[model samples]
Target: MSRIAYVNGRYVAQRDACVNIEDRGYQFGDGIYEVVHLYDGRFIDADLHLARLERSVKEIRLGMPMPLASLKLVLAEVARRNRVSEGLLYMQVGRGVARRDHAFPNTPVPVSLVVTVRRVPPYPSSLDGWSMSAITHPDLRWARRDIKSVNLLPNVLARQAAREAGAGEAILFDPATSMVTEGAATSFWIVDAEGSIRIPPLGPTILPGCTRAAMLAEMAEHGMRAEERPFSLDELAKAREAFITSATSFVKPVLAVDGKPVGDGKPGPVARRLFEIFARHVKGAPRNALQ
Candidate 1:
């Protein structure tokens, strides 16, 4: 079956969906996007994702194309049309077509909205061969990363560099401060020697991740303490275990960085337990049963 996409105000074929060439998003990357993980025919953490979507439009000075309640219906319709259970729902909202000048159009134009879904493999239930290797790269994006904008050239380059280095992801750090910010596309975290869960504090340096937030809540509910503090490269090198989280990758263990083993060079106990906890949360298992 041909994939279906919700473009602007209509449901259309994904292959034929198009935005005008002068669309601000196409010309200046003047748009925001969000990816929500679909699990077992449900949108996992959807409220969080939609909340972020609302925030992104506000940050970028674009009006929401439609009310969120209406958008939710569109999301459900698109998902049903494609019959995607385990997949990603991608939404992009852009300043609609305008004349070729850089500034916002003198007259307000309708914001563009496009939503699509595609199938992906089921989320892993175990970490038994799930360890990944990563490479460190300099964080070279603009400062307003808090907004989930489509401006991702720097991330694309960094991730491509990681792929060329035979690594699964790129852990990007601030060159001047020597502090780890996040991954090319995921949120970074570490289990320190003190057995604490540490993630970089929320700010302009990183895109706050939905999965990262959910995992932190899960940890808190289970009596686990998580510290939102930045860790330097040296600290990262000495971590007991490291992992990255995102909508698609979920909770993935990182066993090595820059070709060197982190901790025992294996998926540590903490990461394995966290993975199970998050998997249970995704499956809607009772919170008390998570421990």
Candidate 2:
């Protein structure tokens, strides 16, 4: 079946969807985007995703293409048209098309909105022996990593580096401080020697992740308090276990980093437990329960 996409204010065939050639998102990477996971025709952590979308748009000084309520409706309609029960919904908002120049246009143009949905495999039944490898790269992104902007050249390079190295993701760190920041496309976390969950605190260096937030809440519910603090590469080398989180990857265990085995070179207890908790949360918990 042909896919459908929401372009600007219209729903059209994906092949026919197009934006102005001068759109800021295309010309200057002046835009923000969000991806929400869908399961059984229901959106998971949608409110958090939309909230983050609003934050990103505001961070870039871009106007919302439509009101929040309207945007949600549009997302639903797009998903419905695509018949995507288990998949991802992507939305992007840009500053808008204008004449070729470095600054905002003298006359404000309506922001551009694009929404698309596609199917993906269902979540794994268990992560017992499942694991992914990662390679470390120097964090070369702009200072405003907090915003989910389309400026992802550094991320693209890092991810491609990982791919070439036979790894699934790239962990980025500050070269000078040796402090771990985040993955190119996910939030990084570790289970320290003391059995405590540790993740880098929310800051300019990391995008505040919805799945990361949900995992923390689930951990708290299970009497596990995650410490929000930066850990060095040397520290990570000796960690009991490691994992990365995102809307798509969920709580994926990191078996190795830069070709070095993590923990016992297997998915550890902490990661397994969190994965189970996260899975249950997404499957049974109400959307409002997360908020």
Compared with the true structure, model 1 gives a TM-score of 0.97
- Total clashes, candidate 2? 0
* Pairs of residues at least 3 apart in sequence or in different chains that clash in candidate 1: none
lDDT of each: 0.91, 0.91
Candidate 2 lDDT score at position 255: 94
lDDT of model 1 at residue 25? 93
Error of 1 at 209 (Å): 0.8
lDDT by residue (5-33, candidate 2, tens digit) is 99988999999999999999999999999
- Cα error, candidate 1, residue 27 (Å): 0.8
lDDT of 2: 0.91
